[model samples]
Target: AQSVTQLDSQVPVFEEAPVELRCNYSSSVSVYLFWYVQYPNQGLQLLLKYLSGSTLVKGINGFEAEFNKSQTSFHLRKPSVHISDTAEYFCAVRAFYNTDKLIFGTGTRLQVFP
Candidate 1:
Protein backbone atom coordinates (compact mmCIF):
# COMPACT_ATOMS: atom_id res chain seq x y z
CA ALA A 1 0.00 0.00 0.00
CA GLN A 2 1.04 3.59 -0.66
CA SER A 3 0.58 6.59 1.56
CA VAL A 4 1.33 10.32 1.55
CA THR A 5 2.45 12.49 4.42
CA GLN A 6 2.57 16.28 4.43
CA LEU A 7 5.22 17.57 6.83
CA ASP A 8 3.18 20.57 7.81
CA SER A 9 -0.38 20.95 8.89
CA GLN A 10 -0.39 24.77 8.75
CA VAL A 11 2.00 27.32 7.31
CA PRO A 12 1.72 31.04 7.98
CA VAL A 13 3.79 33.45 5.97
CA PHE A 14 3.97 37.13 5.28
CA GLU A 15 2.94 38.29 1.85
CA GLU A 16 5.76 38.01 -0.67
CA ALA A 17 7.72 35.51 1.36
CA PRO A 18 9.02 32.25 0.04
CA VAL A 19 7.45 29.02 1.22
CA GLU A 20 8.15 25.32 0.97
CA LEU A 21 5.64 22.61 1.77
CA ARG A 22 7.20 19.26 2.40
CA CYS A 23 5.72 15.99 1.23
CA ASN A 24 7.03 12.46 1.62
CA TYR A 25 5.68 9.16 0.50
CA SER A 26 6.30 5.44 0.50
CA SER A 27 4.99 3.00 -2.07
CA SER A 28 5.63 -0.42 -3.44
CA VAL A 29 4.78 0.48 -7.01
CA SER A 30 5.73 3.32 -9.31
CA VAL A 31 3.60 6.37 -8.56
CA TYR A 32 2.74 9.86 -9.68
CA LEU A 33 2.97 12.75 -7.25
CA PHE A 34 0.60 15.72 -7.14
CA TRP A 35 -0.02 18.93 -5.34
CA TYR A 36 -3.47 20.46 -5.27
CA VAL A 37 -4.67 23.74 -3.84
CA GLN A 38 -8.15 24.35 -2.56
CA TYR A 39 -9.38 27.87 -2.12
CA PRO A 40 -11.97 28.60 0.47
CA ASN A 41 -15.23 26.88 -0.41
CA GLN A 42 -13.80 25.76 -3.73
CA GLY A 43 -12.66 22.43 -5.08
CA LEU A 44 -9.17 21.06 -5.41
CA GLN A 45 -7.15 22.55 -8.26
CA LEU A 46 -4.10 20.83 -9.67
CA LEU A 47 -0.97 22.76 -8.75
CA LEU A 48 1.82 20.62 -10.14
CA LYS A 49 2.77 17.03 -10.83
CA TYR A 50 5.71 14.72 -11.31
CA LEU A 51 4.80 11.94 -13.72
CA SER A 52 7.91 11.13 -15.75
CA GLY A 53 10.83 12.41 -17.82
CA SER A 54 11.58 15.48 -15.76
CA THR A 55 12.77 15.42 -12.20
CA LEU A 56 11.61 18.99 -11.76
CA VAL A 57 8.03 20.01 -12.54
CA LYS A 58 6.48 23.46 -12.55
CA GLY A 59 2.88 24.30 -12.02
CA ILE A 60 0.45 27.21 -11.81
CA ASN A 61 1.00 30.31 -9.70
CA GLY A 62 4.79 30.05 -9.75
CA PHE A 63 4.77 26.83 -7.78
CA GLU A 64 7.27 24.10 -8.49
CA ALA A 65 8.21 20.70 -7.11
CA GLU A 66 11.05 18.27 -7.55
CA PHE A 67 10.77 14.53 -7.77
CA ASN A 68 13.38 12.65 -5.77
CA LYS A 69 13.02 8.96 -6.29
CA SER A 70 15.77 7.90 -3.92
CA GLN A 71 14.60 10.24 -1.20
CA THR A 72 10.97 9.46 -1.91
CA SER A 73 10.00 13.08 -1.59
CA PHE A 74 8.28 15.73 -3.66
CA HIS A 75 8.37 19.09 -1.97
CA LEU A 76 6.46 22.17 -3.17
CA ARG A 77 8.21 25.54 -3.33
CA LYS A 78 7.30 29.06 -4.34
CA PRO A 79 9.76 31.93 -4.69
CA SER A 80 7.22 34.39 -3.43
CA VAL A 81 3.67 34.22 -2.21
CA HIS A 82 0.64 36.50 -2.05
CA ILE A 83 -2.26 36.85 0.31
CA SER A 84 -4.44 35.30 -2.32
CA ASP A 85 -2.34 32.17 -2.09
CA THR A 86 -3.90 31.41 1.24
CA ALA A 87 -5.55 28.09 0.86
CA GLU A 88 -5.44 24.43 1.76
CA TYR A 89 -2.74 22.48 0.01
CA PHE A 90 -2.85 18.74 -0.37
CA CYS A 91 -0.16 16.28 -1.38
CA ALA A 92 -1.43 13.26 -3.24
CA VAL A 93 -0.25 10.15 -5.02
CA ARG A 94 -1.64 7.42 -7.21
CA ALA A 95 -0.53 4.22 -8.83
CA PHE A 96 1.55 5.04 -11.90
CA TYR A 97 -1.16 4.06 -14.37
CA ASN A 98 -4.16 4.79 -12.20
CA THR A 99 -5.53 8.30 -12.45
CA ASP A 100 -8.94 7.93 -10.89
CA LYS A 101 -7.85 6.93 -7.42
CA LEU A 102 -5.71 9.35 -5.38
CA ILE A 103 -4.27 8.93 -1.92
CA PHE A 104 -4.09 12.31 -0.22
CA GLY A 105 -2.23 13.54 2.81
CA THR A 106 -3.65 15.43 5.75
CA GLY A 107 -3.61 18.83 3.98
CA THR A 108 -1.42 21.81 4.79
CA ARG A 109 -3.21 25.09 5.26
CA LEU A 110 -1.26 27.99 3.78
CA GLN A 111 -2.22 31.20 5.51
CA VAL A 112 -0.67 34.18 3.83
CA PHE A 113 -0.67 37.35 5.87
CA PRO A 114 -0.64 40.84 4.47
Candidate 2:
Protein backbone atom coordinates (compact mmCIF):
# COMPACT_ATOMS: atom_id res chain seq x y z
CA ALA A 1 0.00 0.00 0.00
CA GLN A 2 1.08 3.57 -0.72
CA SER A 3 0.94 6.12 2.03
CA VAL A 4 2.23 9.52 3.04
CA THR A 5 2.83 10.83 6.52
CA GLN A 6 3.14 14.37 7.72
CA LEU A 7 5.11 14.50 10.94
CA ASP A 8 3.69 17.79 12.22
CA SER A 9 0.01 18.54 12.26
CA GLN A 10 0.68 22.24 12.75
CA VAL A 11 3.51 24.71 12.86
CA PRO A 12 3.38 28.32 14.07
CA VAL A 13 5.92 30.98 13.34
CA PHE A 14 6.26 34.76 13.49
CA GLU A 15 6.21 36.76 10.30
CA GLU A 16 9.43 36.91 8.28
CA ALA A 17 10.78 33.88 10.10
CA PRO A 18 12.05 30.61 8.72
CA VAL A 19 9.94 27.48 8.61
CA GLU A 20 10.03 23.82 7.64
CA LEU A 21 7.30 21.23 7.14
CA ARG A 22 8.31 17.60 7.24
CA CYS A 23 6.83 14.93 4.95
CA ASN A 24 7.53 11.23 4.49
CA TYR A 25 6.13 8.63 2.17
CA SER A 26 5.92 4.87 1.77
CA SER A 27 5.23 3.45 -1.66
CA SER A 28 5.71 0.09 -3.25
CA VAL A 29 6.51 1.66 -6.61
CA SER A 30 8.01 4.87 -7.84
CA VAL A 31 5.81 7.96 -7.55
CA TYR A 32 5.76 11.63 -8.35
CA LEU A 33 6.08 14.06 -5.47
CA PHE A 34 4.10 17.25 -5.01
CA TRP A 35 3.51 19.92 -2.40
CA TYR A 36 0.32 21.94 -2.42
CA VAL A 37 -0.75 24.90 -0.29
CA GLN A 38 -4.29 25.81 0.63
CA TYR A 39 -5.40 29.09 2.08
CA PRO A 40 -8.37 29.50 4.37
CA ASN A 41 -11.62 28.74 2.56
CA GLN A 42 -9.79 28.25 -0.73
CA GLY A 43 -8.56 25.51 -3.01
CA LEU A 44 -5.00 24.21 -3.07
CA GLN A 45 -2.26 25.52 -5.32
CA LEU A 46 0.71 23.54 -6.53
CA LEU A 47 3.85 24.47 -4.67
CA LEU A 48 6.29 22.13 -6.37
CA LYS A 49 6.99 18.64 -7.57
CA TYR A 50 9.83 16.11 -7.85
CA LEU A 51 9.18 14.07 -10.94
CA SER A 52 12.22 12.18 -12.21
CA GLY A 53 15.45 14.09 -11.76
CA SER A 54 17.09 16.45 -9.32
CA THR A 55 17.14 15.65 -5.64
CA LEU A 56 16.63 19.28 -4.70
CA VAL A 57 13.52 20.96 -6.08
CA LYS A 58 12.68 24.65 -5.85
CA GLY A 59 9.14 25.88 -5.62
CA ILE A 60 7.18 29.07 -5.77
CA ASN A 61 6.96 31.61 -2.93
CA GLY A 62 10.58 31.04 -2.04
CA PHE A 63 10.03 27.50 -0.87
CA GLU A 64 12.11 24.41 -1.71
CA ALA A 65 12.71 20.79 -0.72
CA GLU A 66 15.07 17.92 -1.22
CA PHE A 67 13.92 14.41 -2.02
CA ASN A 68 15.89 11.99 0.13
CA LYS A 69 15.73 8.58 -1.50
CA SER A 70 17.37 6.74 1.35
CA GLN A 71 15.17 8.28 4.00
CA THR A 72 12.00 8.33 1.83
CA SER A 73 11.45 11.92 2.94
CA PHE A 74 10.75 15.26 1.36
CA HIS A 75 10.87 18.26 3.63
CA LEU A 76 9.74 21.76 2.63
CA ARG A 77 11.74 24.76 3.77
CA LYS A 78 11.71 28.52 3.45
CA PRO A 79 14.38 30.91 4.66
CA SER A 80 11.94 33.67 5.65
CA VAL A 81 8.17 33.49 5.88
CA HIS A 82 5.44 36.11 5.77
CA ILE A 83 2.10 36.37 7.53
CA SER A 84 0.39 35.84 4.21
CA ASP A 85 2.08 32.48 4.05
CA THR A 86 -0.25 31.15 6.73
CA ALA A 87 -2.12 28.23 5.30
CA GLU A 88 -2.47 24.47 5.15
CA TYR A 89 0.26 22.58 3.35
CA PHE A 90 -0.18 19.08 2.01
CA CYS A 91 2.29 16.60 0.64
CA ALA A 92 1.06 14.25 -2.05
CA VAL A 93 2.23 11.41 -4.26
CA ARG A 94 0.91 10.23 -7.60
CA ALA A 95 1.65 6.99 -9.35
CA PHE A 96 3.87 7.08 -12.37
CA TYR A 97 1.02 5.70 -14.42
CA ASN A 98 -1.94 7.68 -15.78
CA THR A 99 -3.84 7.55 -12.52
CA ASP A 100 -5.31 10.90 -11.65
CA LYS A 101 -5.70 10.01 -8.01
CA LEU A 102 -3.13 11.27 -5.53
CA ILE A 103 -2.28 9.97 -2.10
CA PHE A 104 -1.97 12.89 0.31
CA GLY A 105 -0.63 13.30 3.79
CA THR A 106 -2.82 14.44 6.67
CA GLY A 107 -1.68 18.00 6.08
CA THR A 108 0.22 20.60 8.13
CA ARG A 109 -1.24 23.92 9.16
CA LEU A 110 1.25 26.75 9.09
CA GLN A 111 0.29 29.80 11.14
CA VAL A 112 2.42 32.82 10.44
CA PHE A 113 2.27 35.46 13.13
CA PRO A 114 2.67 39.17 12.75
What digit string (tens of lDDT, one per residue) describes model 2 on residues 9-91? 99999988899999999987888899999999999999999998999999999999999978999999999999889999999
Instruction: Name every residue pair that clashes in candidate 1.
Output: none
For each candidate in the order shown, give its overall lDDT on alpha carbons.
Answer: 0.95, 0.93
Q: What is the Å distance of residue 22 in model 1 from its true position?
A: 0.6
Worst 10 residues of 2 by lDDT: 93-102
CA lDDT for candidate 2: 0.93
Tens digits of per-residue lDDT, candidate 1, 25-89, equal: 99999999999999999999999988898999999999999999999999999999999999999
RMSD over all Cα atoms, model 2: 1.0
Each candidate's TM vs. the true structure?
0.96, 0.95
Alpha-carbon shift of residue 47 in model 2 (angstroms):
0.4
Residue pairs clashing, model 2: none
lDDT of 1 at 57: 98
Backbone clashes under 3 angstroms, per model: 0, 0
